[model samples]
Target: MTTTTELRVATDGLTKRYGGRAAVDGVSLTVRAGEVYGFLGPNGAGKTTTLRMLVGLVRPTAGTATVLGRDPGDPSACARIGVLIEGPGFYPYLSGRDNLRVLCRYRGLSDAAAESALERVGLRARAHDRFRGYSLGMKQRLGVAAAMLGDPDLLILDEPTNGLDPAGVAEMRSLITDLAADGHTVLLSSHMLDEVQDTCDRVGVIVAGSLVAESTVSELRGGTTIVVRATPYPRALAVARDVAGANRVAATDTGIRVDADAGVAPRLVRALVGAGIEVFDVHSSERSLEEAFFDMTRGSDSTGDDPEVSR
Candidate 1:
């Protein structure tokens, strides 16, 4: 009972090969319109290859992909999508406004759209400045403006925050969230799991060119560990053990750490109180997306598995 409107991007058995090896193997993914889909993986995990195929930069060696109901490489399909691949490219001597104008000209748009695009990226005040004079963050924003020129329905950005300071990273994250909120479908690829977890509505993780997990942030954090602190460590440990199915219950310097199922926090509190343990504080230790990424990608070398091809 799925509707066409529910799917913005779809791939089936997508594979890409190089020589005798596969750069991307039989991978399939679907993204809905207005949904922020995150592609996570380590370097050389085929994330870039998959995105290239999705954008028609490289033809798949084996599988098929569609964007907005048409082949990604189709000129009509490409027109509806905006992409900021690698980093933003511009003429060092050209003003920000001029750079966008150049892009618009190539896309068959009037120069009027260039100014508006600059405004959208919060660079209106500095629109006339040469690209060489802008900071790394400013350059990144300009790149985003270029991508927004056609007012495309879908946006694909890869590591948009690369080479930015902490504040720049924060700003980029906010801008991305705002883009999605404004009804733009975004497909983001990043090695920074924390950024992805914070910004994306759903995440698909790849390891060694193979999809290892796909889920919402909440679903991925379903069984996170909760750390409980009490006056007496041993007493807390004993009470934690009494709680049914408390795995890895151990006494730490401050209190006891236990891995338990979701919705068991309240139950643990009551059990500890009933057992006469002096409970000082209770808190859940949710795993950050970075932690989750490590857990998912650990023990696998980047080149361990042969790549898959999609034509």
Candidate 2:
């Protein structure tokens, strides 16, 4: 009997080049079982290209990857892969149910597969609605449902929430989260930090076709700036600087800011209070995933650094 490894996807030095331009350059990353993994990058950041290679829609120009412990090009492995990359094509005249039925037939899946897929995406009621009549959000949901036709072990979605409005975005987020909850391994790629931060268990950041960083959202927010409000601004500023062991301290309009971890909050409060400074409030401006992204990717062009920081 073959024992299944925990890694759902593993790629090492995965490179793809078009002409002389390197689209995906030496990206090494791993996605473990039963987690919603986020592949984040701006447009043309090679996120789509990387995903295309994984699903065997496009062959890798260089490097290697394994999906379900089999080569990506292996047809047997392809059967265990589900994709909603780009936007799915649906026959405009066919109802959603019929569209899914057609896909099921193509994949040689059963009618139960069609029904379960629609139900999973919460589109069972509208299963009979015409494909062309679907709203942008509905179209996205149907695409997801169609991808579930095979009930594959790994689901790879490229920019699944790209064009949706706020409500649609939230719906897509809910659907992705629910899939992960059902013990499905999902790999979703998007440019939206909020979507990934909300939906993913871990995120790998791509920039200029490089895997620049990979970590959980909380771990990405590693460098937090503590904001402290105390009477006697200068003295409080000195206390913050001393406590945080940081020179990147600045006086805000109402308080002082010091670059440090959230752990420094208590020490900051105690020091100010001990120094007879009236401590009013202390909070960490807590570096957001987006903020950390820019900070890490800043001057990436000049530095050409592929720093992988994980916890």
Cα RMSD for predicted model 1: 3.5
> Which tens-of-lDDT digit does each residue in 115-170 have in candidate 2?
99888777888989999998877888888888777778889987787668887788
lDDT of each: 0.81, 0.81
Cα lDDT tens digits, model 1, 1-311, are: 54776777888889888887777888888888898999988777888788888888889889888898999888988898988877688999999999999999999999989988887777899999999999888898898888888888899887777767777678778888988888889998887777888889988888777778888877765566778887566766777887845456877765677787547779888988887778888887777888788888888778544343211
Regions of candidate 1 where Cα sits further than 4 Å from its true position: 230-238, 246-255, 260-263, 303-311
Extract clashing residue pairs from model 2: none
Candidate 2's displacement at residue 41, Å, is: 0.8
Report the C-alpha displacement of residue 33, candidate 2, in angstroms: 0.8
Q: Stretches of candidate 2 above 4 Å error? A: 1-4, 246-254, 259-263, 298-311
Residue 112 displacement (Å), model 1: 3.0
